[model samples]
Target: MSEVLGHHANEILIVSIVAVVAVGLIGLPGLFALTVPIALFGVVLLSWVAMRQHDRRLCEQCLLSMPLNPSERAVRLKRRFWMAHTGSEPRFLIPYVVVLLASNFATTTTIGRIGWAVMQLSMVYLIMSQSTHRKLQPWCPWCSEGGGGAEVDETDPVLPQDDRQLI
Candidate 1:
């Protein structure tokens, strides 16, 4: 439970920090406020990537260093995958959206509006990429093996594979 709260706190912290910095650097422009959300989302994404990458490292280290039996390893991997799933699930996206939307509403901007626009569009790209990555993580041979999250959803987007992907 604490871990779940911790997860949210960490994400909120990242999003808030990035959003504030972007807002500060860009200066809140009420007229050009659209970009603020974009910048906030963009920085939030960068921070998310950094956090996940670190988690992946830990997963890999566990995979490589743990002396568990095959069954134990599988269990461990599933736990890790679910833990991540819990953290990254769509239900958790609400706070971020709300926060960014609120931030954008806080001020208007004129200068650097283009920069904000870029950040917003880039955030869309990042969101799409991460979405795809999330769907595919269960199937990703490397991620599953390293992050213990490689079990591909049985969904048809990716073909069924041998048990090797599970490992």
Candidate 2:
């Protein structure tokens, strides 16, 4: 439980830091004037990449290094869920970039602010949904090896045959 919570906390911290920095960059005077939407889009992409890398590393470590344990299962399931959700990171960002580009061409204070708010809200919702699902069902064979309380050899051969077949 602690491990799962710790991982969640770390993810939240990273996301929060990235979001703050992105917002700060967007609010800069010269920065915004030069590349308002472009800068914002870049920040989003950079942050997403950073987060994805972090997730991948965590997943690899959990899958390879850790033993089959209850807490480990939770982490694996959470990681799998995140991977599935973020599988199309580039595709997901396209619409936002398009909106940003459109906004840049003809800026409107109301629409721009609302769009930013909507993006933030969506991000928060995604994080919350993942967290909730992790809590509800933390065991998954595809994610964790301890889903059935038995550790199976994931890399073992499916069948054995006589040596003559090889010849």
Highest TM-score, which number? 2
| Tens-place lDDT digits, model 1, residues 42-101 | 666655655454433223433454443644544445544444444355685566456545
Cα shift from native, residue 90, model 2 (Å): 15
Off by over 4 Å in 1: 1-95, 111-119, 131-142, 146-151, 155-167
* Candidate 2 weakest ten by summed lDDT: 148-157
Question: Candidate 2 residues 1-167, lDDT tens each?
Answer: 43444444536544664564365335557755556556545655655555444443234434454444756655656655554345326786577567645644342476666555565545554655444333433354343543542222244435766789779
Cα RMSD, model 2: 10.0
**Each candidate: what lDDT?**
0.48, 0.50
